[model samples]
Target: MPFYSSDSDDHRTPPVKMFGRQRPLHAVFGGGRVADVLLWRNKNLSAAILIGAALIWFLFEVVEYTFLTLLCHISITTMLVVFIWSNGAELFNWSHPKIPEIILSQSAFQEVATTFHVKLNQFLLILYDIACGKDLTLFLLAIASLWILSVIGTYFSSLNLLYFGFVGIAILPVLYERYENHVDYLASKGNRDMKKLYKKFDSKVLNKIPRGPVKEKKFK
Candidate 1:
């Protein structure tokens, strides 16, 4: 008798992995059309999106095209094509071109706005805490993060960073999902090593540092 049955009715819960990501990749990405595109489950759609993004980025960064110019060109081209097609259809007694209706959902916009509002407030609160010197760890971490970003900004233009970010977002998730086990293993090992190093440094250096008596702030 096996400890665990491999029958259709097993219903055994899976062991949780790193970062508490127990759900399938699709579920983790919301299990929707967008998730499908992002995870490359719909390879054609994903490739088209990536290629289109690359083309736009190239035009903006490499060709030095401004947003206003691009918008104007696109609008002019679309108007010319529609006008000619509508007039030609009337003259030729052909069926009218059926333009697809683009409907923007209010709920989707509200959801996005709400999420942004919450995240922005949270970020502001964190910044306030850091500025007030509430936590030394968080303050140092924030400084380090900003300093790193500043260094990166010096080397890369804003457009270059955006393009790189888009490319990474499109590619990295699928790659991670494909080699999730290997990635998790490496990440776990790296995390343990980092913890050990931090502990060693804290004991040897941070623990030896002399501290001055702190003066408590008086509330009015």
Candidate 2:
């Protein structure tokens, strides 16, 4: 007799296209790619919002202050705001992009988290050092300068000068903090081993690349 009679039947069917005519709404909102929108949405929105805010603030300052003071306030606030907004936007962006799901593999995610933690720790350490260092003195100096300027403005009844002076004074510490943070980050990342590796890699690739179109020597 045969080993078995043909009594069994396969019931599985190939997967059918469930929604041939329908499309996901999220695709439309995300411009057809969820990751694309997620990665860049915060940055784009933040830039537009911040730029608009800065322009409005500048106009206000111009109307309420002398041209010189208005210019000073604009210059200082622009730098300070951009530095802060960029970092804040980055952190917000990271958090908003479904961070856990974005890094599906545990090992890969762990590595990224570790790297970020290290950088963050370094940044905080630098900030702590600055706080313990000259931050207090700087704060006092800033307050004194602002108060003096305000008093002068008041004596002259110059609202413009007073307003712009106060704004500029408020921004000084923020600017200093951003600058210090940047310097600290650069210092932390500028490790000897990394520098050597980068240099070696650059030499290997760049030094071997041929220079474009050398001009022939023209003798007079």
Candidate 3:
């Protein structure tokens, strides 16, 4: 009988993650501090973010406040407080409130801009592919997704959707991380079922459909 060393097991590579993810969840979410915040490792920061989002949602949805009105009100209140403080400090010979200077780095701005540019290009490519009718399944999926979104848009205002998205971001990631094994198992099973159904549909219905020679346009 061969004896395996205990240290050898520890040295083995980690098993592949769910949803065909090559990296761990932390790395997939860009790793480091961002992942920590998302996973609620920084509890204080995460709670603060949720509280802020809740306040915004309450202001817009419950209070029926317009964004412009809220902005102006906040600006006026801030200015009034600062104005009073600045003058009162002069009269009492008290120290003025220290306002920290904010500076935006050029490199940070460029990085953000580049990321958006890349994402925008990727979105445009997806739309182009869907429009080109190359993949029937992809085109149908896109159409169905857009139609569902359109229906959802009719029921909820943009602000409501934004708030809901924020709430989902705050909740879903943490829950998923905690129950990742069960979630991944269900997701994989569902995906396999979907593929089987798609294969059947393709063979039964799609194969019978007549097609014309598709003209592929070269993109410059």
**Candidate 1: tens digits of C-alpha lDDT, residues 1-220:** 1122243322242223555567888776556666787799999999999999999998899899999999999999999988898989979997877899988788766655765576588669878978898855556667999999899999999999988999998999899888776766566555455556767978999999999989999999
Error of 3 at 40 (Å): 2.7
lDDT of 1 at 127: 89
Candidate 3 runs further than 4 Å off = 1-19, 89-94, 105-139, 208-220
lDDT of 2 at 170: 41
Candidate 2 accuracy as lDDT: 0.49
Q: What C-alpha lDDT, on a 0 to 100 scale, does residue 65 get in candidate 2?
A: 60
The local distance difference test score of each candidate is 0.77, 0.49, 0.76
Q: What are the models' TM-scores?
A: 0.70, 0.18, 0.69
Clashes of each: 0, 2, 0
Angstrom error of the Cα, residue 69, model 2: value is 50
